[model samples]
Target chain A: MDVWNILEYCAWALAVLFGGHMLIDLARVDSTYDNDLLTSSREGEIELTQELHKL
Target chain B: MTLSSAEPTVQAQASTQGGERLQLLRVLGPGHVWALGVGIVLVGEYMGWNFAVGKGGMIAGLVACWLAGLLYTCVAMIDSEVTSTVAAAGGQYAQAKHIVGPLMAFNVGLFLVMAYTMLEAANAITIGFLLDTVAGLQGHSGLHQPPFIVLTVVFLAWLNYRGVLATLTFNLVITAIAFLAIILLFVSVQLGASHVPLDFSAISTDPLPYGWLGILAALHFGLWYYLGIEGTCQAAEEVRSPARSLPYGTMAGIMTLLIAATLTWYVCSGLIPWEYLGQAGTPLFDAARVTGSTPLMVLLFIGTIFSTLASANGCINDASRAWFSMGRDRYLPSWFGAVHPKYRTPYRSIVFLVPIALIFALGAPLDQVVTFSILSGLLGYTFMTFNMVMFRRKWPLGTIKRGYVHPFHPFPAILLLLICAATYFAVFLGYGSQLIAMMCFYILASLWFHFWRYRFVRRGDQFTMPWPRPQGC
Candidate 1:
C-alpha cells in the first residue's frame, strides 16, 4: 500500500473511533424529559432564575 | 450559590412578583443540543469546504481548516462557559445584554437571526442544486425555481413550529443519518481502487497555487466547516441541565465536527484531484462518482439531501428562538414572542422568518447566500467573545458556580475575538460586494433599533437583564 493509502486507513479508523465514542456517550446519558428539571415547570423556572443570578 | 439555598429565595421572589413565565418547553438534553450543533454545520463537511481547495489547493485548504478549527474550539469553550452560566434561551443575545448592554444585545440578536436565516436559505438553495445535479439537470438554468425554495422554507418552518420535542427529535434522526452517510463515503473511497494515489510531492510544487495569499483567502470556506456549532448554545434553556448539558453537548459537537472535517478533506481529496474537486459544487457526490459506484453516488446524494435539510431544520429552530427572545424583551414587535398555546412553541416567530428566508433563497446566488451567513455569523462570534471577556471581568472566579470554566479565562475569549476579526477582514477582502451588502443591512438594522425599537423598549418596565448585576457596578 502507498503512504496515502495508509494515511486514509488511519483517518477512517479515527473517524470510527470518534463516532463510536460520541454515540456511546449519547446512549449512556439520561436524555429523557422525565427529570425534575423538566417536569416541575415552576420549580424549574425558579432554579434557572437562580442559576442566572449566580452568574 | 448552593442549588438548595438559592431556590427558596428565588421562589419567594417569584411568588411576590407573579409575572408571566416563558412558555418554551424544556424537552432537550445533551443529545438534542449536540444534534442541533452538529446538524447546523454538517452540510459543510459534505460540500462547501471544497471551495477552500479552489482558492488555496489541498495543502492550504487543510491548513485553513486547522486554523479555523482552533478558533472555533476557543469559541466553543467560551460558549460553554457563558451558556452554562447564564442558561438563557436567547443564547449570545442574553449574554450580551447582561455583559455589555441593550444595544449590543440588539445587534447580536439581529445578527444571529440573519446568520441562521441566511444559512437556512443557503441550504435550501443547495438542496435545489443537488436535486438538479442528481436528476441530470446540471446544465439546466431553470432548475432553481423560486416556488421550490419557498416550499422548502414553508415545510421546515412548519416543522419547527410543531413543537420543540418534535423538531429536536427530527434533527437528531437526520443528523445521525448524515453522519452515517459520511462514514459510508469514507469507507467506499478507502475500499475502491478506481482513483489515483495522492501525490505528496505535488504538495510542495502544486499545493500553493496562489502562494501564501491563497491560505488567507481560504479562511471563510474553512470556517464553513464549523460555523454553526454555537447555535447549539441557543438551546441552553431547553436543555435538561444547562449547567451540565450545554458545555458537554457543545464541546462534544465541536469535536465531532473537527473529526468530520479532517476525514472529509483527507478522504475526498485522496479520492480525486484537488483542482477539480475544489471547483465542484457537490464534491462528496463527485468523490463517490470517482469510486465508479453508481449506488454509492446515489447514497451520497441522499446523504447530501438529509444534511442540507437537517441544517435548515436546525437553523429554523435557532433563528425563531432568537427572534422570540428579542420579541419577549420588546426589541421587536411583541407579536414575535407569542407562543402557540397548544404546541408551546414560538409559532409566530417561526412563521415570520420563513418568508424572509424564502425571499433571500429565491433572489441570491448560493455562494452569496453562504457568504452573507458567514459574515453575520462572524459578527455574532466577535460580539460573543467580547461578552465572554466582559463576563469574566464582571464575575470573577468563585463568584458564581460555573458548570464548566474555561481554564485560561480571558485569553481564549481574546484569541477568539482576534481570530473572528481577522477572518471577517479576509472575507471582506475576498468577497467585497456581499460584505458591503451585509454592512448596509447592519446599518439599517441599527437605525431601526435606535429610532423605533428603543422607544418601545423604553415605554415599559418589561425589559430587564435576567442576570444579577455585579456589586457597585
Candidate 2:
C-alpha cells in the first residue's frame, strides 16, 4: 500500500529466499555426505600443504 | 610442526587432498583475523560503553575503561598463546577441551554459542530500533521492526553461508569505516572544529557522584569497551599461519579498541552531560547531532548502521564456528558438522543459529538478553584464568611450540581471576536475579551434558593436536 509496506514485503521475500536455501542445502548435504566423515575429528587440511592467498 | 604426529589433523590433511570431503576454506590472513575480532566489538564503542558514565560519572567511566582494558590485555595475551597452539575453529572451547576435560569444553562451547548468539540478536534488534528512530524523526511512526530484524539476520546468514573470506572482508571494510567515524568525531571536537561548547570541568569537580561503590558498579559496563576482542582466535583454523597471524592480528585488534574506546569516551564525556549520556541509545550519533553539523550527523548515522551490521556478522561467524566444532566432536548432532560441498562453509550451523537469533531479536527483553550474553562472557573469562594456569602446569614452557609465548604467565592469570571476581560483584549489584538465573541455566545444561551428551563425545580423539604428552601425564 505504501513505501514502508513495500520495503517490509521485500524484506520478507528475501528472508524466505535465503532461509529456505539454507534449509534445502542442509538436507542435500545430509543425504549426500557420509555421516562418519561429517562427524570425524578431522577436517580437510588443504591449507596445511601449500600457501593460500593472503588477506 | 610435524603434521604426521597429529592423527586427526594429519587425517584431515590427507582427506582433503585425496578425497571430496568438504571442509572450511583456509583463505584468511592477519587482516581477516583483526577484522573478525574488532568487528564484533567496535559496536560497543558506538553506543553501549557510555552506560558506565550513567552508572557513576565521567571519571568512573574512565576508571572502568582502564581497569577493563587491563583485564582484556591479560585476555589478549593469554588467548593468543593458547589459540596459536590449539589452532582450531572453537578458540577458547578448544583450549578448554585440551587443557581441562570434556565437561569444561562442553560448557565453554555453550558459552561461546550463547554469548555470540545473544549478541547477534542484540545487534539485529539495534538495527531495527536504529532505523525506527530515524523513521520517527522523519515523521513516520508505527514502523514495523520484525521485517528489518529478520532481514538483518537472514541476509548476514546468507553472507556467512557463502564463504568466510567474503564475510570477514565485508566485516573489515565496515568495521574500518565505523572506527574512522569515531576518530573523525574525536579529532574534530579536539580541534574545536565543532563550535559546540564542551565543559571539561565537570569531569574533575563531580567525578564520583555516587562514590567508590559506583566505581564497582561501573566495571560491568566497562567490559563493553573491549568485549569480544579475543574472538579473533576463532579464526585460528582459517588463517594461513596461526602462529604469526593469530597473535599479530589479535594484539593489533586490542590496541585498536583501546584507542577507539578512549576517543569515544573523551568525545562524549566532554560533549554531553553524564546524567543524560548514560541513558542515550546511540550516544555517538547523539554527539554528532549535538554538533549542529548535518554532514557529521549523516556520517555518524552511517557509522552506527555499519557497526551494528558488522557486529551481527561477526557474531554469526564466531557462533557457527563454535557450533560446527562442537558438532564435529559429537557434542551436538554430527549433522551440524557438515561443510557445504560448494561453499566450504559450515552451512548447517550458520543456518540453524539464524532462527535462534531471530527469536530473541523479535521477542526477548533487551536487558535480559544483554545480561545473559555478558554473564556468559564473564563465565568464559573466568574459565580462561584457570585455563592459563592449567595450561602452564600441564605442559610447561618449552614443552610446546607456542606461536606467541605470553610472558609473566602467573601474573596475567592471577590478575584475570581477580578482575573476573570483582566484575561478578558488579553484576550482582545490579543484575543479581539475572545472574542467578544464568547460573541455574548453565548448571542445568552441564548436568544434561554429563548425564546424556558425554556418551556421544570421542574422549581421546578430541585431543587432535600433535603435542608430546603432558609433563604430569
Candidate 3:
C-alpha cells in the first residue's frame, strides 16, 4: 500500500479506538438523582445562604 | 455609614448570594461534561479546518493540526489538574484568581467570555447561512436578516435559562448525532463504488504551497479543530466528584476531538482535490454532493445543522457560566450573578449575553469573527499555562489531594506555555487589528477593576488559600 492508504487506515483505527474509549468512559458515569436541588425553591435559597456564609 | 444601614447592605448581599446559588445546579456527570466539551468545537472539525488546507495544502494543514493537538494535549493535562484541584465554577478564570490574583483573573475571564461569545455568534451566523442555502433563500433581498439571528440566539438562551440539565441533554443528543454523521461520511467514502482514489502524488512536491511560512499561517485554522475542549472544565462546580470527573471528562474529550479531527482531514482531503475543498464554506457537504447522491447530501446538511446547534448551545452554557462566576466574584456587576428562582440556572447572565452575541453574528464576517475568537482564546491559554507553573510551586505533589497531576512536573506546563506564546505571536502577526481590539478590551477590564470594583466590591473569603500551615502539634 502507498503512504496515503496507510495513513487513511491509521486514522480509521485511531477513531475506533478513541470512540470506544469515550463511550466506555461515559458508560461509567451515573446521573441518577432527585430534581429537588433544582426544583425546590426554598431549599435552593437556604443552600445559597449557607454557601455565602461559608464564603 | 451607620451600622443599621450597613446591616441592610449585608442582607442584600446575602440575598444576592442566595439567588446566585439557586441558579447553578450541581448535577452534571462525566457524560454531560464530555458532551459539552465535544459539542463546543464540533463545528470547527466539520468546516473551519478547511481554511488551513487552503493556506498550506493537505500535508501542511495536517502538520499544523498535529502541532495544535500536541499543544492541547499538554493543556488538557495541566488544566485537568487545576480544575479538579480548585473545583470552581469559573474554570480557567478561577484558576487564575487562585494561583495568580484577581487582576489577572479579570483579564482571563473577559477573554474567555469574549472568545466563547464570539464563537457562539459565529455558529449562529453559520446556521443562518446553512438554512438559507438549504432552503434556497440565497439571491434574495433578505439573505442575512438580523431577525433570524436574533431569533436563534433567543431560542438558545431560553433553553439555557430553563436549566443546566435541559441544556446538557440537548448538547449530548446533538453531539452524538453529529459524531455519527461524520462516521457515516467516512464509511461512505470507503465503501462507495464510485469513490475516487485520492491522488497524493499530485501535491506531494509542493505541499507547502506558501513555503514553510504557510505552516505558521495555518496555526489559527488548525486550532479550530480542538480549540474549546477545555471548556468542559468550566462546568466543574456542577460536576459530582469534580476531582475525578473533571480530569476524566477532559481527557476523554480531547482524545475524541483529536481522533475526529484526524479522520476529518484524512477523509475530506482524500475524497476531493484539496485546493477545491479548501475554499468551500461547507467543504464536507460539498464533498458529499460530489458523490452524486441526493440523500448523502441531505444527510450531511442535516449533520452540519446539528453540529452548529451543538456549538452554539455549548457556547451559551459556558459563556454564561463564566459571566456568572465573575459576577459572583464581584468582577462584574452583581446583577449578572442572579439565577432563576425556579429553574436554578444563570438566567440573568444568559439573557444579558444574547444581544451581544446577536450583534456580532449579524455584523461580522466569518473569518474576522473566527480570528477574533481564536486570538482571545490563545491569550487566555497563555495566562492559564503560566499560572499552572506557579500553582505547582505553591502546592507541589502530595501537598494536597489532587485527582490527577501532569507527570514530569512543570515540563508539560512549560512546553504548553512556549507553544501558546508562539501561536499568540503568529495570531498577532496574522490579525493585528483583532489583537489590538483584544488589548483594548483588556485595558477596559483593568480600568473597571481598578476604578470601580477594587474600591467598592467586598470579596468573599472562599477563594483565599492558606499556605505555610502551622506545624502540627
Candidate 4:
C-alpha cells in the first residue's frame, strides 16, 4: 500500500482508540448518588414551582 | 457620612449578601473583565496566522478585529437595556429564556455550555502547545505527547475546583503580572525602535483587497478576539449596580481590549516582521525572544503564563454561570443552581464544569479547538444581535430602560445578522478537521442530552433561553 493508505490506516486506528476511551469515560458516570447532576434546586426557591407550573 | 446613617447601607449589604448569596468576588467591575479581555486577546494573537498573510493580511486582520468589536458593542448595548427591566439572575440564558420561549432558550443555554467547555479545553490545549514548544526548544523532543496536555488540564482543573473567590483572586494576580509583562514588551520595543526602520506600507493598500471572501475570513477570526465582551452582561446581576455598571462595564471592556490589542499588533508589527510572526510556533513569545534581551524574554514567558491562567479562570467563572442559570430554570437540574453556604458560590455546577473543560483541553489540538471556539462564540453573538432586533418590535422601546444604544439602528443590526450568518455557514461547511469534528460532537451531545433532559431526567419544569409561555388552548 501507498503512504497515503498507510497513513489512513494509522488515522483510523487512533480514532477508534480515542473514541473508545471517550465512550468508556462516559460509561463511568457516577450514579451512586441521586444528587449527582447539577440539576437539583434548593428546598424552596420560588421560581422552582412557578416554572414547573408553566410546564 | 454619619455612622448611624451607614446602618441602612450595611443592612442592605447584609440582606443581599446573606440572603441572595452568590459567588464572592463574582460581581467584578468592568476593569477586571477588561483585564481578562486583554489576556484573551494576547492569547488569540499568539495563534494568529499573520505570517501566512504577510503585511496585507496583518492589516486585514486588524480591520476585521475592529468590525468584530463593533458586533460585540451592539450585543452589549442590547443586553444593557434588557438587564434593567428584569431583577432575576442568569445572564444570556436568563435573558433569552425570558424573551424567547423556553425551548429556544434551552437550546442557547446548552450551546453556551458547549461553547465554554470546548473553549476551556481549547485554551488548555493551547497552553500545552506553548509549553511543548518551549520545552522542544530546550531540547525535549516529546513535547507534543499527551502527558503534557493531560498535566496542564489537571492543573487548570485544580485551580477551578478551588471555588470562585480563590480563582478570582488568583486571576487578579496573574492578570496583573500579565499586564506588566505586556507593557514592558511595548516599552522595550519603543525604546529599541531606533535600531529598526518603521514600516507603514502594511495599511496603505486597497481596503477589502480580497473582496468579500477576505473580509468574511478576517471577520471569522476577528470574532475570536472579541469573544468575552458580553461576559459582563451575563454576570450583570452579580455586580453592585446592574443598571449602570453592566452597560458601562461591558462596552468599556470590549473597547479597551480592542484598543490595547490594536496598539500591541501595530507596535509589534513595526518592530518585528509579520513573516517572522507567522512562521514562529509561538509568535508572541518569539517576538520577545528575538529582541536578544534575556530579561525581556523571561518577562514575556511570565506574561504568557499569566495570560493563559487568567483566561482559563475567567472562562470557568463565566461558563459555570450559564449552567447555574439553566439549573435554576429547571432545565439542567436544580443542583447546578446550588450556592455553597459559606462561600456563596455555584460550587456544584462549577464542580461539573472544570472536568468537562479539562477533557476538551487534554484531548483536542489547539487550532482545531480555536476554530470551534470562534464558531460557537459567533453563533451566540449572531443570535443575540438578531434577538435585539426582534426585541425592539416585541418589547416596546419604552420597556427597555435608558442605556447604551447602537449608533445606527437597523443598518448596523442587519449587517451584523448577515456577517454572523455567513460565518456560521462557512464553519458548518467543515473548513477544518477539529471544527468539523467538534461541531458534530456538540450537536450529537446536545441532542442526546436534550432527549435525556426532557424525556427521562427532566425534573419539575424545563427552562429555555427565550422562555416559552403556558399553553392555554
Candidate 4 regions off by >4 Å?
Answer: A1-55, B1-27, B33-42, B49-56, B84-89, B143-161, B193-212, B400-407, B425-452, B455-473
lDDT of 4: 0.57
Label model 2 with its docking quality class: acceptable
Question: Per-residue CA lDDT of candidate 1, range B1-473, in tens?
Answer: 33222233354345335644434656678999989999999999887899988888888889989989999999899888877776777788877876777788899998889899999999988876765554454343334344445556766776776678788889899899888888877776667644555444557669699888888888878999998999987886567678898899899999999988988888777777877878888888877787777778778888888899999999999998899888877788765665553355666677678779988898888888888889988888888776876787887777767788888777888788778877876797679887888889888988888877788774323324344456458
TM-score of chain A of each: 0.55, 0.70, 0.52, 0.53
Reference-based lDDT, each prediction: 0.76, 0.85, 0.73, 0.57
Candidate 4: Cα lDDT at B451: 65
Error of 4 at B71 (Å): 2.2
Q: Estimate how well candidate 4 is docked, as a DockQ score.
A: 0.07
CAPRI accuracy category, model 4? incorrect
Instruction: Compose the digit string of candidate 4's lDDT tens values, residues B1-473.
Output: 12112333343345444453222223455555455444444455544534223323666667666776666666666666655434245566666755655565676776667666666676666666676666667666554434444444445544544444456566667766776666677777777723455465655654445655665565555666556656655554344445556666666666666665665566566656655653455555766766767787788787776677677666766777778777766677665665543334565676677568766676566666667667667757766776766666665454434444445566666777776776665454446565667668767766766666655434434332222332331
Clashing pairs in 2: none
Off by over 4 Å in 1: A1-55, B1-22, B137-144, B193-201, B458-468
Summing lDDT over every window of 10 consecutive residues in candidate 4 chain A, give the lowest-scoring window.
A46-55
Question: Tell me, what's the RMSD of every candidate?
Answer: 10.8, 4.0, 12.0, 8.9
Number of the candidate with higher lDDT, 1 or 2:
2
Residue B177 alpha-carbon offset, candidate 2, angstroms = 0.5
User: Which regions of candidate 3 fall more than 4 Å away from where they truly are?
Assistant: A1-55, B1-23, B137-144, B193-195, B459-473
- Structural similarity to truth (TM-score) of each candidate: 0.84, 0.94, 0.83, 0.75
lDDT score of residue B139 within candidate 1? 41
